[model samples]
Structures are given as C-alpha cells and as structure tokens.
Target: MRILFFDTKTYDKESFEKQTGNYPAIEIDYLKTDLTPKTATLAKGYDAVCAFVSSDVGSDTMDALHEAGVKLVLMRCAGFNNVDLEKAAAYGIKVMRVPGYSPEAVAEHAMALALTANRRIHKAYVKVRENDFSLGGLMGMNFYQKTAGIVGTGKIGAAMAKICRGFGMKVIAYDVYQNPELADFVEYVTLDELLASSDLISLHCPLMDNTYHLINRETIAKMKDGVILVNTSRGGLVKTDDLIEGIRARKFFGVGLDVYEEETKNVFEDRSDEILEHSTTARLLSFPNVMITSHQGFFTEEALAAICKTTLDNAVAFEKGERNGNEVEERQ
Candidate 1:
C-alpha cells in the first residue's frame, strides 16, 4: 500500500522513515504541505493518508480524499477534533489514531512546564546568559505540601498525578470516569472543589464540544489566586481571551502552555521572520509569566517512534480489512 503523510516535519520524516523497515509491504511518502480541501487531491494515487494534529480533515477535504481513492486516514496524534468524523464515515473512509503513544511524554512535559514556570527558569536563564545572575525576580514557591489538581484522569493525567505525588504534593483530580488504580492516592473531587483548592492545575482532557474552553473567566475565578496553570492538552481547552483577562487581573503566578487556541497558524512552522497577525497570540507573548511552547509535548524520541509504529500498524490493519480500537467513530 502507498501511504502519503501530510503536515510532516523533519522529525516526523526521520521517525517514520526509520520505522519503515518494520512494515515491508507498505511504501511511505512524506509531504510537508498540510492536508486541506485544496491539497486533498494530492492523495489520488495513495491508498491511505497519514495526518497530524493541525491537518484539516473537514467535510470538503474528506470528500476530496474519497474522490482521490484514499481509503484510510491515519492520525499520528491523539486528538482528532480537526477531522470531520461523520463525513469520513459517510464516505466510507476509515479513521485511526495513535491514542496512547507515550502518554508519559506529555505528562513529563507538563511537569517540566509547571516547574519551569513556577521557578521562573526562563527568566533566570536569560539573566545568566548575560552574566547577571542576581536572584531578584526568581523567587518561587515549593511544590511540596501544595495542592495539585489534574483535570482529567486518563493515562496522561494519571501519569501527571503520579509525578505530582512524587513531589510530595496533595493531589486531587476530576474526571467523568475515574481510574480505579489511582483512587487510593489521588482524590477524585468535583470540578469546583478542585479549582478552588489547587495551587497548581494541569489540563489533560481531549477537546470536544463539552470540553471547549473548559477554562474561561468564570472557571478562572474559581481557581486560587496566584495559581500555576499548565496545559499540555488540546489548544481549545482554554479560552485565550479569558486567560488574558485573568492574567491582567493577576490571577495566575505562572502559565505554561504547550498548546493554545490559535495554534494551527504557527505551532509547527518557523514563522519567526513574518509579522504575527494574530493579536491575541502576539499579546500572549508579551506577558512575562506566560510561557508558550510550539505544541511539542509529544516530541520525545519514544513518543515519535511509537506514533510512527502505530501509524504503520493502522495502515496494515486497514490493508487486511480489520478494525481496531483506534478506529474513530462518530460521537452519538
């Protein structure tokens, strides 16, 4: 089978190329262009197309891909909010994703973000680079004995809870479906309780209609003053405008975001030379306590390799006419 990969980066190409040896029957091609309605016709000769988080797989793109003879859509990342699942199902196009490709990588990155933001590591690094290492604005609080709230108790959230526990933090979590294994240690509480009590909060939930803008002005008001917020989850989980307001009111001590609302425009690309037209994104960059990463929570070597392997495995499953749990279904 011929599989085309869209919205691919150098790291994606390197990882996917290295894993091609494991699936000898499949031929892979990398395309830096993102999958959109205009570019969907490029999948004409390929049996399947592999996409990433930012690729557009809406109704028009799905229709185009179906016309192009693309039978399968393999998403290398976990979130599929960008895809039009009902449209794909209607077109008889199978969609599969790497759902648990190194949850630890994301969990660890959340911890890194939390720690970096809390201690003002970025500012300290800049100061030291200029041989001026005075600890004036570098004061930070200890995580020990502090309350850490996890918004979701999925694989990634559970991993983050474990790390917070390791730091001697009082961990509380809120999830619709709580993990039984963590019940003994991580207390499952209501969203209001979690928000009210937590000194540090991390979001690890998926983006959906119900979860969109989970953190907004009202929710921010519920959180403790001077809270440290970390989001390694989907971008839409937090409302950027509300967050900006929160920052202006001095509601947060630090904010670390690996993903943001307008991420599709600039996350994976090198657009530093161009003028940033998005005012919110530009304003976000001006805050001293805010740190934004280029949606790289899952950029670890282990995660990239796993994503490639699972992507190939999904394609192999498609060739055999077999359905796996990774297949996405329209939400009822």
Candidate 2:
C-alpha cells in the first residue's frame, strides 16, 4: 500500500518512520505541504493520503482526491472536524482516525497550563532569569476544596477529573451521557450550575453544531468571578471575541488555551519573523492573563508512538478490505 503523508514535520517523520518497520507492506512518501484541493493531485499514484488536524479536506479537496484515484483518507489525529465527512462518503473515500491516542497526555497538559497560568509561573521565570527575584503579583489561590467543572466526561475528561480529585477538589461534570465509573465521586450537574459554581472549568468536548461556541458571552457571564478557564479541545468551542470581552470586563483570573479558533494557520509553524497583523491570536497574546500554546497537548512521546501505530494499522486494515472499528462516516 502506498500512502502520501501530508504536512510532514520533523517529529512526525521521526515517529512514523520508527513505526513503519512493523508494517513492511506500507510505503509512505512524506510531503511538507498541507493537504488541500490543489495538493490533492499529488496522491494520484498512492492508495491513501495521511493528514493531520490542520489539513483542509473539504468538498473541493475530496473531488480532487477522487479524481486522483485515492480511496482512503487517514487522519493521524483524533479530531475529524476539518474533514467534510458527507463529501468523503459521496466520493467513496473511507476516512479513519486515531481517536484515543493518549488522553492522559492532554489531561496532564491541561492541568499544567492551569497551574502555570494561575501561579504566573511563566512571568516569574522570566523575571528570575533577569536576576530580579521579587515576588510581587505572584499570588495564586489554592485548589483544595475548590470546584472543578469538566465539560465532558469522555476519556480525557475522566482523566482530568481524576487529577482534580487528587488535588482534593470537588469534581463536577456536565455531559449528556455520564460515565458510570465516575458516578461514585463525580457530581453530574447542569451546564448553568457547573458554570456558576466551578472555580476552574476545563473543556474536553468535541466541536459539533450544538457545541460550537459553547463558551460564549452568556456562558462566560455565568462563570464565577476570578475563574480559571482552560481548553485543550477543539478551538471552535469557545468564541474568541466573546472571551476577549469577558477578559476586558475582568471576568477571568487567568485563561489557558492549547487550541483557539485562529490556530489553523499558525499551528506547528514558526511565525516569529512574520508580523501577524489583524490576527485575533495576536490580540489575545497582548493580555498578560492569557497563555496560548500551539495545540501541542498531544505532542508527548507516548502519544506520538500510539498515533503512528494506530494510523498504520488502520491503513493495513483498509488494504485488506477489513473494518478495524476506526472508520468515520457521516451521521444521518
């Protein structure tokens, strides 16, 4: 099986190449360019094209891939919101993804961000580096006995709940379907209650029609004063403009985001030399309370190895005409 891997980075190449030896029949060609309508023709001779979360796989790209004789679209990441699922189905392209590639890696990163932002660790580190060890504006609230509201109780949210429990926090969650395993300790609450009560709120839900901009103006208004907001999930979940307004109103003590709506053009790319004029991300960076990472919650070594193994396994299954339970289809 021949696979054209798009958006190839140094880390992605190193991880995938190390795991390719296990699947001898798979031949992969790496391309640094992202998968788009114009780049779809590059997959003419390959059976499938591997893509990341930032790749554009809309209707036009699907049409081009169909014309290029590509039958499969393998997403190396968990989120498939970027791909047009209905168009892929119409084009007879099977889409598969790595859904649960290391939930703990992301959950740990979320807690790390919360701690860093709340304690002003990033600022303190820079201050100490300049030989100035003053301890002003570094006060942080204790997490003990505070309420931690998890927006979703999926694998990653569940892991985050456990971490908060270890910190002696009261864990509350809001999900349509509650996990039975967490019923013993987690309190299932309504969205309003969670927003009004939680001292710290973490979002771990997928981006869908109903969940789009879930954390907007109204929701932010419901949150407790001096609340800490963290999002390690999809960027569209929070409305950036509304968030900025809430920040200006002094609604948040600190905000930590590993993903944001404007991250598509900047993810995994170095833009230090370029001026990001008219960028919402640049505007968000001007605030001292906001800390944004480059969507790197799943960049750990364990997560990378697991992602590589599952992606190649999915490709091998497709070649053999077997379903591996990772296939994604459009919902009716």
Candidate 3:
C-alpha cells in the first residue's frame, strides 16, 4: 500500500518504521508538513495517510485527500479531535484512530502533575537549584480526603479516578456519555455540581465543539475557592485566558497543565529555543501557581510502543478491507 505519513520528524521514524513490519514492503512517503489541505494534495497517489493528533483533517483537508484518491486515514493518536469525521465519511474516505492505546501513560502523567503541583515540587526544586531553599512559601496540602472532580470516564479518566480514590480523596466525575462502571465507583454529578464542589478538577475529555472551552470563565466562577485545575487532554478544552484570570483572582490555588489552547505548532514537540512571544502563555508561565508541562502525557516507552502497534494495525486493517469501529463515524 502507498502511504503518506505527514507532520513527521526524524525522532518518530525509528519507532514507527520498526513497527510497520515487512508485509508487502509497504510503500511509505514521509512528509515534514502537517496534513493540511494544501499538503493533502501531495498525497495524490497514496492509498492511505497516517496523521498525528495535531495534523489538520478539517473539511478542506479531507476533501483534498478524497480528491487525491486517499481511501483511509490511520490516526496514530487515540484522540480524533483534529479530524473531520463526517466529511471523511461522506467522501467515502474512512477514518480510524487508536482507541485506548496508552490510558495508563496519560493517567500516570495526570497523577504526576497533580502531585507535583499540590506538593509545590517544581517550586521547591527551582529554589534548591538556586540554593535559596529555606522551606518558605513551599508548604503544601496533603492529597488525602481532597475532593477530585474527574471529567470524562473513559480509560484514562477511570484510571485517574482510581488513583485519586486510592489516596483517600472523594472522586466526583462528569461525563456526557456516562459510563456505568465508573459511575458505580465515584459520585457522578452535573457539570455545575462538579465544578462547585471539587477541590481538584482534572480534564480528560476530547476537544470538540461541545467540549471546546468547556472550562471557561463562567465555569471557573462556579468552582470552589482556590481549586486546583489539571488538564492532560486537548489544549482547547480549557480557555487559557480564563484560566489565567482565575489564577490571578486566586479562584484557583494551583494549575497543572500539559496542554493549552492555541497550541497548533507547539504541543507534543519542542521549539524551546524559539521565542514564544505569546502573551497569554508568557503571562501564565510567570505565575507561581501555574505549572506548565510540555504535552508529554503519552511520552512513556510503553505508550510509544502501543501507539506504534495500533497505528500499523490500522494500516493492516485497511489492507484487509475491514472496518475499525474506533474510527470517527460522524461529527456535527
């Protein structure tokens, strides 16, 4: 099969090529550019295209791929937020994504973020590095008995819920599509209830129209005073400006973010030496309460292997003329 892997870098080649296997000597074309509409035209002769979380698969891009005779979209990442699912389906170009490849990887990272932020570990380490550690402004609250509101009850959310519960924290969750298994373990409540009650609100939902800016100014207003907010999900899910305002107002005690809005060419990859020049992010980083981590929730070795296996399995599945249910079916 002729395949085009877009928005790629040298780092991913080793893991992906190694897992691709030698079956039929798959003809692979690597593109440094993301799978945008302009770039999609370059996939003219390819049978399929593999895209990552940030690769553009909007309406124009999907139409371009279809026009280029691309039949399938094999997404390397589990989240299908970037894809135009309905457009792909209408164009007879099916799409599939890794469903739950590395839930533990992301969940563990969320746990780590929560722990570090709550314990002020980052601040303490920076102080120690500067040889200015006097244990001042470093006192932190214990995790035990804290109310944790977990949004989304999927594999990752459930895993995080379990961990927080194990820490003797009361777990409250809010999910549009309810999962009874997870609901049985934690208190499931309305969005307002969760926001108003939780001491720590962790986001694990995908980014879609409904979920975009889910955590905005109004919702932040409902949250408990000095609530801790943690997000390892899509960047757009939380309104960064509103979050920053919340931080300034002292509405939120601490923030542990692995993602942020306006992260098109930023997240998952590092361009550290480049000047960010984004005021919101610059201001956010200046805050003592905010802890930002480059999106590395899925950076574990196990997660990478799982992502590769699922990605290649998707290619093989398309080759066999079968459907992968995890793929996006519709959007609207």
In terms of lDDT, which candidate is strongest?
A: 2
Off by over 4 Å in 3: none
- Of the two candidates 1 and 3, the one with more favorable TM-score, higher being better, is 1
Itemize residue pairs with steric clashes in candidate 2: none
Better model by lDDT: candidate 1 vs candidate 2: 2
Per residue, candidate 2 scores C-alpha lDDT tens digits across 88-127 of 9988899999999999999999999899889988889888
Give all candidates' CA lDDT scores.
0.93, 0.95, 0.85
User: How far in Å is the alpha carbon of 227 misplaced in model 3?
Assistant: 0.8
lDDT (Cα, tens digit) per residue for candidate 3, span 188-237: 89999999999889999887779899999999999999788999998899
lDDT of 1 by residue, 9-33 (tens): 8888998889898899999888889
Model 1 residue runs over 4 Å out of place are none
TM-score of 3: 0.94
What number of backbone clashes does candidate 1 have, counting pairs of residues 3 or more apart or in separate chains?
Answer: 0
Q: For model 3, what is the alpha-carbon lDDT of residue 231?
A: 95
Put the candidates in lDDT order, highest first.
Answer: 2, 1, 3
Q: Model 1, 317: alpha-carbon shift in Å? A: 1.0
